[model samples]
Target: MGVIPFLLTYDIIIKFIEKSSIGINYLLIMSGGIILSLFLKGYLYFQGLNASHEAAFDTLMGMRIKFVEKMRKAPLGEINAKGVGSYKKNLIDDIDSVETLLAHMIPEGIPFVIVPILIYTMIFVTDWRLGLLSLGSIPFGFIPMMFMMKNGTKKMPMYYKSAEDMNNTIIEYINGMEVIKIFGRTTDSYKRYKDSVEGYRDFTLDWFRESWTYMAMYTAVLPCTILLLLPVELNVYLNGTLELSKFIFSLMLSMSAGVPLTRMLDFAPTVIQLTYKIDQLEKTFEGVQLKEGNESIAIKKHTIEFKNVTFAYEEEDVIKDVSFKLRQNTLTAIVGESGSGKSTLAKLLVHFWDIQKGEITLDGKNINKFSVTDLMNEISYVSQDNFLFNTSIMENIKIGNPKATEEEIKEAAKLAQCHDFIVEMEEGYNTIVGDSGDKLSGGQKQRITIARAILKNSPIIIMDEATAFTDPENEDKIQAALSKLIVGKTVLVIAHRLSTIVDADNIIVMDNGELIAQGTHKELLEKNHKYKTLWESHMKSMDWGIQVEEEEYA
Candidate 1:
């Protein structure tokens, strides 16, 4: 509609000058048509824009939901391997980048395309010779655009990779800032952060440099549809092959034709980017997803058995031919040196990653036979990480059992030995934890997580260094709480501190991903040289101290 007035406005001015008898009525009708065309053009464009935005927002919401679901269904090991930073980019940044393409390309680009076709047809119909002259610059203009697209395609993956690396590095730097400050290693850490920033900057500049020359050429040449027509049409008029009015009409149509083509070409890069983002998102879902039964199974008992389980994160096995069983209503402790696969064993039991060879069973049923939700419902896990969300203390605990009552939450917190401190705070249970529970001390966070597990009251509990952050004064209280929680429940404890697990019913010692010893703590200390060595080292580390007061007196 706008295109009609645009082309007519040119024709009307030329016609009025050629025929002065075209009176005030004709001029009034022309003005009214122009006004109507502008009104219709604005109205229709906005209507399409409103529809496009609604569709785009719906699509965005669905896409984000699907991505989150995929992440949940993905194997935990794979998620950890990809790192959190890349997922953040994919889920938030990459998904957001598609909005503009969806919102503008369909509504706006279509009109830009249709209007150009109509304008070009009008030019050709008016005078075929002038129409051909108007399009003479197209092939030349496309040359630079093609080169630009080619360069962009070749360099885009590398550019995204650099960006992903920078995101990962910056996330790590921010997360580890406290540790860096504590160790007085700010310079070295800041050097890594600076390097990532500078590297991203350099990659962006280099990517831009690759296409800038072509971009310049295309921008200068692509919109000049009438550049060739003007000179050639003038020559034709001089030769008496073209009329003045016809030449002017053709020129007007040609100018309008170039504008839409320019707009269309501008959208080309956005199309490429949209495709790339979709491809990247698809790649994120390509890895092994956690397979589970559609039907949820009833867990008859809390017994867990590993039947010659062999597993590996990569090539080398993290757990080789490992076999163990936790009987119902038993407390089992797994003790080992650092990097001895103790953590891996606990994670494997939870089906964090499927074993390379062998089977793990829960209640005499293959673990894989149970739905993910059903399996999660049967076990409570508190890892050393102790990650907490930015929410109220009560809400954080309630996450263990979403339907749990307020009294149940407070009871769990009291059992975990953090209720007193929580009550002492200004907001009590309503106090909002900062990001990852940064507002709380390490001991406080660990206790809160433990309280969550206690609140859940699952039949099986796996605690991977759950007491790591507890100070000496609070260790006994935590142990007392854990004692009550583990009663009548199968429990697996992975601990570095020998004293904490000495009273466990059965002790399993692993070395180099293989279970080397299994016995009572007393039996291991008497018969197992490896466990004895670890126990001795632990005792010395615990007992080591200086006689500072005596030295000062001397």
Candidate 2:
């Protein structure tokens, strides 16, 4: 950026000397030197831009990726309220708009600014009258440009908003395509897509119309400078108001000044657009917040604790003043009906939302203090909605422990009761699960998810609705595997299959987001109406009405 202008200046100086006849060889020699230097500078600039472009792309991409990674470890309620589509739009599409500003407007535009300053300086010494004429004409061209900016400014926000809507529409359309297809609502997506595109198109046309309207007045009709300069030059030539050479030089230099001023005018819209784009990026980047220690790479020892916690969402009190201790090495089952905050309770334990009136600690330290990654590492979570990547069964299992050996992966699969079924498939563990594990049934997906958690080997295990949908046959096998997994671990289970955790060391019962009862299954049944009813329900569901069996809840 700094080199190109000086080369141009040197070339101009050679031409000036040739006009002055400062040794004819001087023109040839200096001109050749300037040409060669310009070629070298051009080559170097192109090469530098190539390398810079590569670096810029990587840096920008990493910035976006890291931004997302940061947000993933934040409060789920906040992230959801903001909408994933909007976040993606900000992270990718909005950021893409800044690329031109950074790569072109910043680096290349520096020289444009400097070259004008050099022109003004040279013209000032050569002829103050022409310099004044040059300077005066530059500002006159801006009258039309100022009006152009005023109109374009009004439409800038509309254009950007239209782009954002397009991004949001694409996300929603893709995500809901199946529903759209099932309901035969295909035109919804097309309409949304078309509307967003049309908005951008209309706004862009308006912007161009404003520019060209002003452009026609400024360029086609000749700027005030030409009308103004013509009189000054003719008066000087006819009346001998100045030296012929000086008058001649002034005319040529005045014309040269037009190109830069015109260029500066051409760049006016870019400057405006780039400014707005940068502001948009800054707004998004600043609005997103992060928890402390979230950037640390080390995992710390911590225990999950809920202390007099009260959590609510908008107007719904999902957890009301509930207090419990999740022991360091005990299996704790939290059994409750739907809307009893079973899954919500699990979310609390993982610090997905901060309790409104209570504190959650890990190893006696606040969960907020630990870096997000560190906190996640302390607990292996199996959400009610179990998800798997579209990859090999082995790869999905290995996600929990990236460096785990094949043997270790197989061991986790066996423990989760997934190994046998996986091996039955032709490709075995190598079989692709398809998108979100669609190739597998719900039960198969659940088992693989369990395998993933088992492989994580976190000190704390949270299994929310862990065994709810498994068939009786697979349920038994999964229960057997889970029995081994929960032993000597701080385990929190949210289960609807009440029989599976009948002997849990502790059972917590929640109703309307409040802890109604908590105790051993036998103790709870003896003391609480809710527990007794739930126990009776479980017994009837098993169809063991008259069968003799060991009564753990007796």
Query: Best by lDDT, which number?
Result: 1
Task: Report the C-alpha lDDT of model 2 over 76-139, residue by residue, as the tens digit.
Answer: 7767776766677778766676666556544456555666677667667876776676566555
lDDT of each: 0.89, 0.76
Pick out the ten consecutive residues of candidate 1 with the lowest summed lDDT.
545-554
Shift of residue 190 alpha carbon in model 2, Å: 5.5
Measured by TM-score, the strongest candidate is 1
Query: In model 2, how large is the Cα lDDT of residue 154?
Result: 91
- Model 1 lDDT vs. the true structure? 0.89
| lDDT tens digits by residue: candidate 1, 1-554 | 85677667786878777775777888899889989888998898899999999999899899999899888778787898888789999999899988888899888898888887788788889888887898877888899898888888987888888888888999999999889999999999899989988998998998788778887887788899877899989999999989888888888777777778888889988889778988999888676787677787777788999899998888989898988899999999999888989998888777778788989999899888887788889999999989999999999999999999999999999999999999999999999999999999999999999999999999999999999999988989999999999999999999999899998999999999999989999999999999999999999999899876545553
Give the poorly placed runs of model 1, Cα more than 4 Å off. Answer: 17-20, 242-246, 539-542, 549-554
> Any idea how many clashes model 2 has?
3
Give the least accurate 10-residue stretch of model 2, judged by summed lDDT.
Answer: 1-10
TM-score per prediction, in order, is: 0.93, 0.84
**Candidate 2 versus the native: TM-score?**
0.84
